[model samples]
Target chain A: MIPYLACVLLFLIGLYVVISKRNLIKIVIGFSLIEYAVNLFFALVGFKKGALAPIITQPEQVRMGVARNFVDPVPQALVLTAIVIGLSTTALMLSLAMRLYEKYKTFDISEIRRLKG
Target chain B: MEGRILPLFVAIPLAGAFLVPLLSKLWTRFADLIASITSALLLGVSVYGWLMVNAGGMPLHYWVGGWRIIGIAMWFDALTALIVLIINIVGFCASVYSIRYLDRYTGGRWKFFTLLLLLIAGLNGLAISGDLFNMFVFIEISAIASYALVAFGTEEEEVEAAFKYMVLGEVGGAVLLFGIALIYARASTLNLAHLSQVLAGFGRTPFYWFVIATLLIGFAIKMGMEPFHAWLADAHFSAPAPISAMLSGVFIKVTGVYAMSRLMFNVFGVSRAETPAFFNLLIAFGAVSMVLGGLLAYTQNDYKRLLAYSSISQIGYILVALGIGNFWGIAGALFHILAHALGKGTLFLASGSVERQTGTRNLEQLKGLEKTMPATTWSHILASFSMAGLPPFAGFFSKLFIIIGAIAARMYWLAFLAALFSAVTLGYLTKVVNMAFFVKQNSSVTSTREAPGLMVLAMLVLVVLTVAVGVGFRGVLDHLVGPAARVLLNGLEYARLVLGG
Candidate 1:
């Protein structure tokens, strides 16, 4: 329960930073924070108390409730994909930030003022 | 339903994206050859898929690796077929246009073909894939490609718009991912078909409604609907012209509209009977976008930016039709998707041709083009007429159907607004026609060149489609959009069709 609330809090915090920050790099950091919060939520959703890793050594383990004891791997798999996407987008964001710096000579988004309407 | 053809919608483009860079290294023409062939093949497959769906065996399911529940499912029905067809047709035209369109750009022009193919693959997968998480992956795939393409010029403004687009788009993606996570946690199934079946028994609690709202807001940003539309005009105006066409034509439709419709209707079984608030909200949002977008479009000096706003307005029409929540309403929405795709594709490609020829997008500067670029001018005029809801053009039929739909739903004022906006649409569009084409300030500009052969041909193809679909709208609505709209109308039956049959 606490972790879930924390996830929501972190998401809100990241969104706040993204909206409020003027520095382009800080905005990218906010993006990464938002992604991490979602990934954490997905990870938390899959976690179970005393759950075993989802590896079956033999068929008899299924009858012994090993499957029940196993944490749901689906969300973990989903988070893996989400994290990779997050990384790629963050990398692209940082690179674009770099290019923005080269062109505008500032890390401040407020200063880079070319595109309007 | 035929099972073998589902993967080819994605495979051909993905393979083409892989092969184009290699082939371009050998010879630049090979890149064009391969990209056009790939998109042509995709268009062919989409048509074939439509035929198969139309033949009555539908809600086709292809189980990946033959795994029933765990492996990803590729689902297709009338809705999927329609969206896929739009994606491919626009893709084919854009690839053909790109052949001549890339002549002005320097530095590894072959890279553009690769990104374009990648974008198509992303759209194709987004439309066809049944797993919600996989759809997110495809969203990223196409979206990242678009981000790069939007910044392809790497000029100061292009990179800035691309960065802005990426930030907003990635945030929307995160929100969507969060929603998908909540859904997966509750439903325990990622397959949309199976989730629909399972969710049939669940009560609509606040949590359920929250999930719906999150998904709605996420896609709203993607589609650039109303309040969340800040990134659209910037991104559309900043991208190169052909890329602009693809972005405005089908990307938002597939990413935002198609995805939202699929989830809300098929998976969640949203209905006017049950979710009046949701449908009403959709209607309200649509109306706001229609009026506001039209007004904003009228104010823009850049022709592409104006077209971008007009895209928003047209998207509003589709949403309002969807909100009508009746057969004609949904059918109209489906029809408008195609109509706007053709109409907007021609207009944007024409803008590209003009930009290429005169090297300017300012309406004030472009003068007396009707004589110089006759093919482009006529095609642009015809497309603008269609967009302005003139008769014997596809836009008129779509607008007519939507007005009929609103009347059928007893929403008289909404119906009136629909008609009124047609004139408002014409009012702003003619500003472009008059300022850009009819202003006879220069005989010297008449000495300027026409667009190269293929670019004009591309615009002609879309213009022809607009006229053809308009003239043959009855057959179109009956054969294609009717089934697609029915799938949305009988939303829960989608589950039965997919899981039972």
Candidate 2:
């Protein structure tokens, strides 16, 4: 319960940074932070306190109803996929920021406001 | 049902995406030929799929690797067919336009085609995926490609706009994933069919409402709803014209509106008797988007920016129809989706042509183009009439259906406001025509030719579609829109079909 709340807090902090920060790199970091928090929360949802690995290498454990004590592996797989997507997108965002810096000579987002909203 | 054809939608585009770059290295013109051929092929496949489904064989599902519940599932129902038709037909036109239209941009054409194919692959995947997590990954694929496409110019404004769009899009994606995580934790499954069955008995508790709200907000931001639309105008204005057309035409509908409508009506059962508030929320959002988008669009000087805001307004009409949640309402929503895709797609392509010829999108700078660019001007005239809900155009019938749907639902004020905004759309568009065409040629203007033959051909195809859909809407309504709406109206039936009941 506490870990879930902490994950939500992390997500909120990232949201705040994205909303309040002016630096382009900081904004990208904020997005990464949100991704990590969601990934963490997802993993937490599938975690069991005293669970064994989901693998079934032994016949004995299979007979002992080991599936009951096995942690959910699907969330871990999902988290891995999410992390890779996050990494690639963050890389793209950073490269775009580098180009923006080249064109505008600044990292501050407020200074990069050529297209009016 | 022809189950095998489902995967071809994703595979063909993915193959084309990679093949274009490799082929481009060997021959320069092959990229154009291959990209056009690929989109045309996808268009053919989508039409064939629609014909197959319309012939009484539908709700076909395929399990990847034959893994049943363990592997990802893809389904091609009426709703999927409708969206696939929209994506591919518009995609085909955009690809055709881009072949010649891209000569103005500095980016490599091969890279553009590759990214475009990847985006189409993602959209096709999203439209057909039977699982929630698979949808998220597809959304990411399309989002990433679009982010890069937005910054394809590498100009300062383009980069800035792309960054802004990316930041908001990422947040929306995260929130969307969070909602999916919550749903997964509650149901202990990721398959949308399985989850729908589980959620059927779960009832509308506080957690369910929370999940619905989260998903709604996430997709709203993605679709550029009125309150969350800060990034839309900027991104649309900054991207190249073909990309702009794609963004405004199909991207918002596929990723945002269609996804949200499917989830709310099917997976979550928002159309159930207990969920009056859900419909009310949609109505409220629709009202806001309609009024605000129209009012704001009336003030824009940039041609593409104005169209982007009009997209938001037009989307509001579709949402209001969907929110009504009646037969005609759902059908109207579907019709509006197709109508807007053709009308706005043509308009944006024409705007791209105008920008290409004049080298500026500013209304103040571009004047009397009808004399020089007749094809573009006529295309503009047709699109504007359709967009403004004028008689005998495609936009008119769709908007009329929405108004009638609202009236049938006894939402008199909503119907009236929808009519009023149709006028607002006309008023602002008249300003566009007045300044860009009717006014005398500007002093700095030079002789301009029609947009390249292929570009004009693409725009003409959409214009013809706009007219054909308007005149032949009775056949369209009976065959396509009716079935798609039935899919939404019979949400529980979807669960039953997918779960083999």
Candidate 3:
């Protein structure tokens, strides 16, 4: 329960930073934070107390309550994909930020004024 | 002819994307050859897929790695066929246009083709996937590629716009993932067919409704609907011409609108219910987008920005038709998607030509282009007229059907508003023609010429499609649009077809 609340709080913090931050790099960090929060939530959702890893060593294990005693593996697999996608997005944003800094000579998003919308 | 053809749509582009850079190292121009050939082959296969669906009168579902009911699969129905056809055909034309238009940007043809191929692969994958998580994965692939493509120019405004688009787009993606997570936790299944069956039996709760809203809003940002359209105009205007055409023409529809419709009508069973609130939310957003987008476009001096805003407005029309939530409404929406793809593709490609030829995008400076660039001028006029909902053009019939659908749904005022803003569409577009083409040439400019042969060829192909779809819309309606709409209208049949009764 506490972990779930922490995850939601982390997500809100990221959202707040994204909305309020003036610097481009800070905003990028905010995006990463949001992604981490979501990944955490997915992981938490699939949690099982005292559960073993979702690996079966023998056919007898499958016949017993082995599956029930193991944690759900789907969300972990999902988070792996999410993390990679988040990394790509972060890398691209950082590169764009570097380019923006080169062109505009500032890290402040508000200062880089070209397009109105 | 088999379910096997679906993966080829993704495989061909993926191969070309990776191969282009290595091959370009061997021969610099080989990138162009490979990209065009790859897209053309995709287009051929998509057309064949369309015909196969039409002939067989059922979906072709392919299970990957022979994973029966529980694993991921590719589902190609009439609806998927329509979107796949749009993506590949427009993709081919854009690649053809890019082969020359990319000359201005140095040393990145390989990178450009690589990202473009990835984008095409992602759109194709998104269109045909049979599961929710797979759809999200494909959306990320396309969104990430598009973010890079948006910033590929690496200019000041380009980078800024790309950053803005990425942030908002990433937020949308995260929200979408959260929604999917919520659905997964509750429904305990990821497959669309199985999920639908479970959801249909699982009574609606507030949590379910929350999930629905989250998904809708997330995709709204993606589609650039009225409230969440801040990133669209900037990104569209900043990207290069071919990229701009692809983004405004088909990318938004495939990722945002098509994904939303698929989830809502097919997986979530919105089409089965009257769904007044859902319908009203769509109508409200649609009407606001149409009116606001038109008015804002009227004030824009930038050519591409104007086109981008008009996209928001036109997307509003599609949403309005969809909100009507009837057969003709959805069919009209589908028809409008094709029509706008062709018309807007022509406009963006033509704008690219104009920009390349005159070295200016200012309407004030681009005067009397019609006198010098007759081919481009005529094509632009035809596409602009079609987009403005003029008679005997594609946009007209689609708009007509939408208005009729609204009226049939007893939304008389919404229909009236659609018609009113359509006139506004005509007004702004005419403003474009008068300022950019009809006025006498600016005395300061001396070296305006017709666009390159490839650019003209691409524009002409789009213009021909615009005219053809409009001229022969009756047959289009019967063969393509009707079946596609039926796929949405008959929601339970989708489940039964996929998972058996």
Judging by DockQ, tell me the better candidate of 1 and 3: 1
Per-residue CA lDDT of candidate 1, range B155-221, in tens?
Answer: 9999999998999999999999999989988889998888988787787889889999999999998
**Which portions of model 1 miss their true places by more than 4 Å?**
A56-68, B442-447
Whichever of 1 and 2 has more DockQ, that candidate is 1
lDDT of 2 by residue, B1-501 (tens): 357889999999999999998889999788889889999999999999899888965666888888888789898898999899989988999999999888897658898999998889999999999899999999899999999999888888888899889999989999999998899888999888888989988987899999999998899988999889999988988888888888888998999989998888888877736688988888899889989999999999889989989988988888888888888888988999999999999999998999888888888777878888889899998899999999788789888888888898899998899899999999998888888876565435533687889999999999999999999988888888889999999887887898792
Shift of residue B356 alpha carbon in model 3, Å: 0.5
> Using Cα atoms with residue i matched to residue i, what is each candidate's TM-score against the true structure?
0.97, 0.97, 0.97
CA error at residue A43 for candidate 2, angstroms = 1.0
Tens-digit lDDT track of model 3 for B1-501: 368898897899999999998999999899999999999999999999999989988789888888777778789999999999889878999999999899888888899999999999999999999889899999999998899999988988898899899999999999999899888888888989888888988766787689999998889999999999999999999898888888888899999989998988888888526567787788789878888888899998878889999999999988988988887788889989988999999999988888888888887766777788989889989998899888888998888888888788888898888888888988888887888877565534423678889989999999998888889989888888889989989876788888762
Report the TM-score for the A-chain of model 2.
0.88
* Cα-based lDDT for every prediction: 0.90, 0.89, 0.88
Segments of candidate 2 deviating more than 4 angstroms:
A56-68, B441-443
Model 3 error, position B140 (Å): 1.0
* Candidate 2: share of reference interface contacts reproduced: 0.85
Residue pairs with backbone atoms closer than 3 Å in model 1 (clashes): none
* lDDT of model 2 at position B444: 56
